[model samples]
Target: MAELQEFIDDRPDAREVRKALAVKLVYQGYKYEEIQTILDVSLGSITSWKQAYEEDGISGLRLNHKGKKSYLTAQQREEVLSWLQTKECWELGELEYKLAFEYDVTYESKRSYYDLFDAAGISWKKTTSLNPKADEDAVAAKKKEIETLLARHRQEIEEGKLRVLLLDECHLMWGDLSGYVWGKTDQEIAVRVVNIRDKQTYYGAVDYLEGSLLLKAYNAGNSENTIDYLRYLLDQSPQSKITSFFGDGASYHRSHLVQNFLGEVNQDLSQEEWKIHCVRFAPNCPSQNPIEDIWLQAKTWVRRFCALIPSFSHLKWMFEWFIRHTTFDFATLQMYGAFSEIKY
Candidate 1:
C-alpha cells in the first residue's frame, strides 16, 4: 500500500494506473468507502474500478478504451437528444447517416452507434401513424368553418335543442389486441390463438350532448353500411331535436345517395320539426372527431385481457361491453382541444 501510494503520488498523470492501484487495494481487503478517502476518488468510481478488476483484472481499469473516438462531443450529444425529441419519427440508420454527414462522425460498429443512443437516453419505438398527405391549407379552412358553425349554434347548444354527434369506425382482430406487454427478453409472448387473420369491423357514433351511443358490427365499412347506419340513427333519435352528423371525408358520408336522403329529410321537415345536417371534417384528420378517442379507450379496455378472452364471440362481447360501459363525458373529451366548441 505504501509503495502504491508513493507510485501514484510520483506519477499523478497515470490515471488508469492509479485506478488499477485502487482496485488492487480493494482486492487486498479495503472497503470501497474507505478507499474513496485515500484515493481522492468517488465511492462510485472505486466500486466500478473494483468491478473491472474482478471482471478483467487490471485491463478493465484502462482509459481511452471506449473504442474509436465519438464524432460528437458531450455538448453536441445533448443537442442531438433535444433534436430527436422534436421529430415525429425517425429510423436509427437514417439518424446515423445524418450524424455522419452533418457532424462527420461515423461509427465503426453497431454496438458503438447504439452506445451513443443509449447515452442520449433515446430508444427505438413504434412510430405513430399520421397522414402525411393531409393538406395544411384545407385543415385550416375546416378549422375556421367549424368555429363559424359553433358560433352559429351557440344558442341552440345552450338550450340543448341541438344534438352533436361524432361518428367513426374501428376494427377488432383475434391476435394481440393493441399494445406491448411484459414478457421474457428473447422469447415472444405466445398464446394458444386462432383466427389470426379474421377481423370484425364496427361503425359507432356518440351524441356528445346527451351521451347516447350507437354501435353496429359489420363485415366491412363502405357506402352501404354507412347509409344503413344513418337510417338507424335517424329512426332511433327523437323526432323534435335537430341532429348534426360530424364525420371524416369517407366517400360514403358524401355519396350522392346520402346527400339526397339528407336533402329529402330536411325538405320534408318544417323549421321547428326534427331535422338533420352534416359537416365534413378536414382531410386526413381523425383527431377532429372526439369519437376516435372513445374507440381508443374501448379497445384499450377490452384488449388488456386479450390472452384470456376465449373466442371471437367473447371478444366481440367484450368490445361491446367496453363501448357501452365507457363514460361519455363531453367536457372531458372536449378538453382534448380538438374543437373549441361542440356545437357543430
Candidate 2:
C-alpha cells in the first residue's frame, strides 16, 4: 500500500498558526532572548517558530505579529523564485551574483549558503539506474588466469629457445571524434574526419614481452594478410628466425592459411636452430595475449597525432610513429583484461 500524508492543522487557526507569531518576531531581526523578553514567550517557543519560518517559507511567518521588522522583505523572496524559474540547473554561485549586484550583500560563504539551504530542503540530485548483481568474482578469476598464463609463458620463453610474438588488430578512424574529451561538459568540440565513410583500420604483430614491432599494415586482417606479413618478415630477415607466435582468436588468425604458413615455416627451417609454434587465445579472452596491449598503445599514439597527417594516403603509416618515437624502449607489459604496455 502507498503511504498517505498524516493529518496536519493546515487551517489558518491551529497550534502551527499560533507558532507563527514567534517565527515572525525572530525573522523581524529579534534574537530569541529578545523575542522571549518582548513577547512574553519562552526561549523554546522562539526556537520552534524560527525553525518553521526557515523551513516553510512565508506561510510559516503568518503568526500575526503586530509590528516586526522583516529580516527578508517579501520582494526579496519573489526575486529568488523568479531567478529559479528562468534557469534549468541551479548553481549557488549564480545566485550569489544577483545578491551581490542588487542588494550589495554577499553570502558569507559556501558553508553559509548550504546551511540556509538545508532548512529550505532544496536537495541536489542525479539520475541513475539501479543495476542488479556484480561480477567482482568473475573479474578476479580472470586476473588470476592471466597472471598464471603470463608466468608460464615467461618460463617457457627463458627455458626454451622459443621466439614468442603476440598478434592483434586495431580499427582507426580518419578524423577527430568526441567519444573522448577534456573538461566536464556535454558540449562537443567538433573535429573533422578525413573520410567519414571508409575510415581505416590496421593489423599489427609484436613481441609478447619485449617491446618490438614485428609487422604492421593498413589492410583487412584476414588469414591471407597474416600469412603475407609473415612472409614479408621472412624475406627481410637473414633467416625466418621467429619460432612461436601468439594471436587473439580472430577468424583470420585461426584459419587454415595461417596454420599452413606456420607448418611450412617449421618444415623449411633447420629443426635444431628454429621451429615455429602457435598459441591460440582462450575464448573471449583477448587480454590473455600480449599483442592486445600493444594495440592499445597504438591507438593512443594514433589518437594524439592522427590530425597532423597531411592526407589519408599515409593514414596507415601513423602507427609506425609509435614504433619510432613512443617511449617503449624499456616498457613493461601488463596482462589483465587485455595485454597493455606502458613506459612508466
User: Taking the tens digit of each residue's C-alpha lDDT, what string does model 2 give over 55-91?
Assistant: 6654554545322222245577566656566645566
List model 1 lDDT by residue over 131-179, tens digit each.
Answer: 8888888878876776676557656754566656677878877663645
Show model 2 residue runs off by greater than 4 Å.
1-161, 175-188, 236-240, 268-274, 306-310, 327-344
- Residue-pair clash count for candidate 1: 0
Best-matching candidate per TM-score? 1
Each prediction's TM-score versus the true structure: 0.65, 0.47
Candidate 1 root-mean-square deviation in Å: 11.6
